[model samples]
Target chain A: MTQTLDIERELCGHAAVGEAAVTVDGDRVVAFVVPAGGGLSLRELRAELGTEPDEFVVLTALPLAEDGQPDWAELSRSRKDLTRRRMPYTAPRTDTERYLAALWEDLIGVEDIGADDDFFTLGGHSLLAVRIRMRLQRDHGVTVAPEALFENSVLSEQAAVVDRTREA
Target chain B: MSQRTKWLLRDPSPEAEARLFCLPYSGVGASVFRRWPSHIGPLEVCPLQLPGRENRIGQPAYGDFPAFAADAADALADHLDRPYAVFGHCMGSILAHALVTELRSRDVRQPERLFVSSSRVPHWPPDRRYRMPAPGAVGVYHPSMTEEQLADEVSRVSRTVGGTDLHPDLLPLALRVLRSDLEMCFGYAPALAPTGCPISTIGWSDDADVPPAEMGVWQECGPVTHHVLPGDKLTFLEAPAELQEVVEKDFRG
Candidate 1:
């Protein structure tokens, strides 16, 4: 059995909640106890595990209890089967290709614009600016200010800002 | 024809009563009214192209309302071989009004009918609150917020309806055009005498940007005929048939 002290070791650059006590069985983390109102959902917990729990893992939070004890078996079955998919937490390619591809698809007549181009320089008025921001947030979970568009005026610069601010 | 620059003509019949010249709204080129000829029967539709757009991009953009209106009047003068009508939307409406005045000043034949769409009459006190967003003001024109952000912003600014992701390259040109248009409207002083042409105003009821009540102010132009259409932004596109009917009734008489 791995000691609670060893299991409490910081993981993924994020500190575990004060009340949450981690238990490790061999190389795998088996379970953890989180505060009642920490806003942590079972889905988030499962995501942190990198895989769904087996029958042994359990949640004791009162909010999670449907009737009696939480059903780990059914929850495990509902969890998505892991494919060779990269998680959102993973760092993306440094190359600007992906960002440019996204910009091209969202913006009409993007071929007429250059990559280092500014949004306002290309005939993006207020109406179109709103559309661009909405598309970026929806597609990439990135929040960009219209002012930032005018300031940076280039894909690479905007992409750098988003990359730096990307949520873990 | 000094090097024809992508002119789309609609001369349905050789004996059409009048040549109707159409002008586009802000941020739009002449191509928007390219299909007007098919709809407005018994009339020849000649959509006027503004400078610094499409094939005319090489030409310097007009700096003010007088310059723009003057250039348009000059461009149309040679084309006005027949009795003509004038129809314009938004910025075009203002230009059309000015063009009529310029024509009168030059003793040129006036348009028999003048149709203004979704614009307030020139003399109405301008709305002070309706400030044009600065060229690079972030999130002012486009919602910088997430969907959640947009909902919050939209709830606040009722004028903004839909959002679009604009091309970066066109941003500068678009800003220049927007700034110039705003300045033109803001600095405009309405002329006293209404144009001698018969006037009609068409507007969308649900267009928050140009509400029907505000659009009604267009009646100050002359013997005004107002037509209100139901629906939201770009409602004219939705009911082109109805719009065409109004144009036919007005122009045929």
Candidate 2:
């Protein structure tokens, strides 16, 4: 069996779970789960799996794609719901933070990036980071090392890097 | 007629050290490599023409990747006379891996190298994950996309990659092909079966669909050499000199 199927089967085998589909969201393994009539919990699901799942989103029913399979892509996208952010969504307040957030919008394809959002966690990658650097120099006239994006990718953190580098 | 003539849109070069079989991405034909030279250094470019697109417009498309791979491996059986490499972009990258795996099972000649460009690793089925809600933002096409949405994707990609919107007459057929191709991609979720052949994962600098950084997952598949060059997803279409240089160096060493 395929790895994806094996994971899905294991998810179904859980006594507390009704229906579930698994997908990779960037670096995380997210399971979109529909509970059995008895119900289930993220804590229980994680405990059952042994290793902690990155996320377990509870749903009433599994959504199927046109192919009649669980729509994993849509499920993956659903996990990125802003309402459920790990940290509260704080709008970009500083000048550099706002500028970085706008670039994040175009490159990551997400809008209204929060100052607290981690770039990699929010699906930002190397190319996007490089683009961020290029635009930072081009638009804001600040030069940040490539490692800055890797080490400090959050909007506020990155903005600070820009501020420090420009002053230097 | 030999599958050689039927599968390869152009004739193979007898003098080359190896053949580089080029696979097209979704909704198009072998013509995606139209601008590519006949050969890059010693490697001859043999672009494969699948059914239901381009020259084979009336034929039916393959239902899935496995069947396509099986048939392709068989069709190109005669051409496996020499060491060859496989290259694919986006959907073609998945197809490229499938074909390489199929060749291994058949115990036919194996590819010296497999170039998978602009795609996620095959272990998990490819999914369309839009990081945000932005206009003309396509995470990757899926079954549920509306006609209007698909049109926008087609326009945006064509404009971005090919530098012009698809012609009005070609839009309908392109959309049809695009939808079918997207379905095939979402359906495939293969195991991380590493090929005996070395893999070179190619990530485009400006490719928004599959970022260069994300291409690192391919290391799990096998011995892989990753390169993130300057260009977008379709930049390979234009056959950049830097890309050719990489293929030449890889083939030579």
Candidate 3:
């Protein structure tokens, strides 16, 4: 077994955790655990474990292999699909927000971005920011500076900047 | 026609209280600073238009940092009439350091401050090899990286800096510039040296390329002031308020 698997076994020893699986994903150590009591705060759980992981993923149950070990490949897919974004799905509330959200969804290739979801957190890189800038200018008549984009990277914050620019 | 105007992208105001000479990183020219406003506080932003990119596309690029610094010192000598500061990002940081060293060696007036962002100290001990951020299993650049990998890195960095990918027509030249620059960086592993100039090392909160903690090594470079601000490595392009405050504060009389 790997060192990560050992971590998984040790985490199972925690009373707050019903089940746990560990994996190394691209220089990040992610711990997928099922809370014994309906739920447990990540911070409180970390304090219980006595070590910090780069990412903490909560799951209902651990996928298992035929040999009864944790299914590594399935866990990988689950992590990719669900673990990256922590914010709940939130649709845009205002026209400016809706417009900014639309631009971000198209450029960032992610859907259902919440007001607080950071652009960089969604894998939004500089290239995408420039595309959003061009689209805003050409299609929406909104001229946004790259600095504006950098500072106001969240969906609602970006919308506010656009609204301010328009008002001015 | 003067050397000053030839080297600098624009003729900065002589009447200004001070000037900030900005240097571009590898594979690009002064145009990278096009987004920066003309003036911040008393310091005028004067980006150096190095040879081999943009308007100087026809000229051969410098193969070594010392040689580039020597030529720069000569060109910028007479222009240093007012108090000035030097700002460099990434490869430009090392170039900025080298330029300051060159100026000191020539007994020229030094910049009031040196602003280095997203760089490790120039003269790291012989063992620490610096590599480009690339994709895939190896996850870092090596001289053996394929042309495709280098091209991808160029595109990634360009995009990371808030620009789109390179057009097909520009890829060949871009790749050449990238290869040359990477070679220069990888070849550079000088002994740790202190700066005669005051230093301001800026670190970003979200920069994976060079983490903020890694920047503490810069304290050995000189009388140093360190800043940890919100944003990624490329966010410096935005001229964040905290960074501006640091620059203005450092250059303050």
Candidate 4:
């Protein structure tokens, strides 16, 4: 059996769990779970799996299509909820910060971005990250690694990286 | 042909000297290119729609890029009577590359050029977490996600494209299609060998995900020319005038 199926089966084998799915969100492994009855807690699920999931979400029932397969569209709704609890906001101050913030707003489709805002929290993914890296090189003639963005998702920190690279 | 089997040929031109077939990034459908003009000079814009999304929602999603390419190449056989090129953005670039190779393998005509925007060459291992299986490896890994996450992505992406919030009722179908598309992407393992056609890559200046340098690795496939376009990845959806100008000049030349 495929590893994904194996994980699902093992998850369903746990008490109080009727169905489970393991999916990746960026670098994290998120498991969507349905309980047999009442409400199942993440603590209980974690104890049963013996391994902590990066993100654990409980669903009344796994969304199923008319064909009876798991509904991925419904499952992906968890990303919305996750974004709400991300790190606090910080406003961009530097010129470089302003430029990136505008771009971020465009790419992320988020209206307002504080300097403390997390890129991933704003719906920034690898593809969008690549776009930002390339834009910096073109517009500023500065080179920075993609990892830099991941490490310094905050606007202030990211501006520091660009400022440092610009000076070098 | 069944209604379910139809491809999205935004503007079909049988007489056009060159055809440009576009593939959507993972988790998206052809509608992503809805704003793209019908023509880039003489080249016709053909946005090929994969199954399990948009109008193709009734069909089963292909398991991997190779399978998707194989089927796409076959279905597009008649259209290939003329000189054509395949364009894919992000993970869609891999699909375009695999489709070109699949066409060559079946003795079908190869594309005149392959345009890959915002993606690395197939040889490059993907993100560490969803790394591609080693060469000669049989399968790719698919990441499991919850429906809420998928809904958030769809809603987020939609807002960028001038779309309103995705209703809760639509989340199930949307996420299902996204998961299937990601499965095809994560499971894809195209042959590492080079193609006869030249390659052109477009990188967004501010993109941090797949930097222009990473896109440079595509040179290994064949002659590669990289162009830096303004804006982020989502800019491609707008099909900005600058992007159109570059593609027009490149394809026409």
Candidate 5:
């Protein structure tokens, strides 16, 4: 019954707010529609993919054809300026670098931890991750979800993720 | 005062019925009560900013609780000329109680009412362990744990206290303040000082740091009316409206 309920919930578009429905293949988010005003804005979305809209629109638009999918391709380029204003900081360098440096110093008492070193592998945990997130937000003025630390555990890898996120 | 101190004022009315002075908890400065005046009408809210934080970072922090109380009481003497009440949270609560006692000793008029939050009576010993880690010793407690593990612990503790994940940079400063507070509480042996002011005790529903059971110790000091709020944790910031209302009611009554 629980498994059926879970499946029912998933079939109902995972109940995610503003998320467009797309094909799901076993645990993967696969193709997803960029819900209008719900998904990242074009400027934010563009920063994540690190490509110009002209070069990437085709790839992004492909997912919109799926059943129950959102019309991501309908996003108006005229709104690019408004989207750019809402996107996170863009210093050519990602916030993850600053966060990682502060985190390493606070946790291990080391001046610097290599960007390639895994955050968890170096004895980082959820509590410290929240602390890192809080510090980044408070000290470095970076907004990061707690999951970011776990998803990209390495410092440089996290930076790459942030860079890609900017492109997207 | 010659020093440039940053103060977040919340004076609801220039001709307020009464003034309410609030003190912050250990490791926390006055900005915590910045929103109190907006909720509680007809009262002048003055949130006291202690040394060593925000704009006063250059000032040395008080080393002992009595010294801190003395400094606060001395500074507050001039501001107490009008109709006023006093409120404090955690260590600030105890300080508020002690300051009332000091006022009596110095023959100053007492506040209309006193509100104490999240701390026991002035004399009770603290229950938490005092384990101050030396410089560069991250392994003193859960050193081998991953950042996820640490963040989980922080989240759990914060859930119990109505706070979010602890900031990494602020953690070190908090630890230092916690150590000093623990030392003060641990080293304290209840003295014979007493105050005649009416007191109200405010407790959070799920505050593990200062449990409800231990708060009964506050009754030893003087007459106290206890009130508890419902929440996953007990924090002044979480229920500022409720706290302000209760304080205003108590002060008027």
Candidate 6:
């Protein structure tokens, strides 16, 4: 089996983790785990396993198919969904969102992105993020840092930043 | 005239005895090497401006290593009519190596030397720990961390090493370039084919990122000459006089 699977199995064996799934995101080994409840931290989990995951995401539950097998698509969707819900932002509704969404779709190649969709989770990287920023400057005369995407990846939040910049 | 094709070179030289094409590290443009003299003795400095950067801001970023190398080789073809060498620091090292292979595949003249700094073998899986949000912490691009946490990390880094402040206005653009370069670095897994060109690997005496000892692995690519210059990884940016002297000496030899 791949080392990622082995790590996932080990993580599941922990008393704090009821179930776990691990995958490679870029160079990072990301483990999405359903904890056994009652105060388990990533630091504590790493200490128990003696392995530091590139990213340790604590999930409410692992997505499973009707056959009781882990559903990979659902798991990916869950990760993105979890990210969107955590950030305090609404869906893209303004003209800036429409403009930014089109540019993001072109570079990230994703269709129908909501204002709540996370850019990084949608496979947005630094280069693509820069493309978005450049396009904003060229087309809209709005400029923000690349970290703005990292901070406010949601379309609406980013749009708000640009709107604030425009107003200022 | 052909300078349009080789837009990566901010300062193109047509009358120099030798040319040294310098590739910038992640998230930066050719402007990073703007401090370097246009001519070090007879060796003209030509800093490469990759796509999605300062001048090529509108061009699409190269998705992979081979494609980037191919584009660079094609753009640099006319300039290669004269003798030339290649230099890359950090992420630029991989570009330098891949570009050499691309040139060879096209049956073009090869560089006299391949100078790589603060980078590992092309095949090695990326060391994600290289870029930290804090001194010893990992910075995830995801929203797992609070926006405040992300801001703190980016601000801390922008204060040091990156050469400029994280001006809210330009930080995103700079980071976008960095991310694109990193994606290229992460996806790089070249075939185990060694080049015929000689290699020179530079390391900082106090660089914790790419230690001087780790530099020996570059020998697998070619006959390597390792040089551990004084100061840390950012030393090249802080005081380039020593680096310039070393390059001048090496090029002369």
Between the candidate structures 5 and 6, which one is better when assessed by TM-score? 6
Output the better candidate (5/6) by lDDT: 6
Error of 1 at A1 (Å): 88
| lDDT tens per residue, model 1, A1-168 | 334444334322233333333444345554444334332333344456533323122222211235754343333221111110111222224544355434532342222234444333332334444555666678777776555543343455656655655553
Q: Tens digits of per-residue lDDT for model 5 on A69-138?
A: 4433322221221122121323223456765655554553222355545454333444555666666657
Q: Compared with the true structure, what per-residue lDDT tens digits does model 6 show for residues A1-168?
A: 387887887987888788898987778787888767654556556767855567655555575678997766666554453343233444568899988776765554344567766564444544456667778889888877655554566578778988988788
Q: For residue B180, give model 4's deviation from the true position in Å.
A: 1.9
Q: Count residue pairs with overlapping backbones in model 1.
A: 24
Among all candidates shown, the one with the greatest TM-score: 3
lDDT, residue B165, model 6: 43
Docking category for candidate 1? incorrect
Q: How far out, in Å, is residue B31 in model 4?
A: 1.7
Candidate 4 interface RMSD (Å): 18.9
Candidate 2 runs further than 4 Å off: A1-168, B1-4, B128-140, B161-163
lDDT assessment of candidate 1 = 0.52
| Native-to-model Cα distance after best TM-score fit, residue A42 in candidate 2, in Å | 70
Each model's RMSD to truth, in Å? Answer: 19.7, 21.3, 17.9, 23.0, 15.8, 22.4
The number of clashing residue pairs in each candidate reads 24, 1, 1, 49, 34, 8
Q: Per-residue lDDT for A93 in model 1?
A: 42
**lDDT by residue for model 1 (B115-138), tens:** 887766766544531333343222
Tens digit per residue, CA lDDT, model 2, A1-168: 255566678889887778888776677666677767553545445656744446566654575788999876546434543223223678888888988887776554454578877665444444456677789879978877665554575679788889999999
Candidate 1's displacement at residue B245, Å, is: 0.5
Give RMSD (Å) of candidate 1 vs. truth.
19.7
Q: Comparing candidate 2 with candidate 5, which one achieves the higher DockQ?
A: 5
Displacement of the residue B19 alpha carbon in candidate 4, Å? 0.9
Candidate 2: clashing pairs of residues: A110-B132
- Off by more than 4 A, model 5: A1-168, B1-14, B127-167
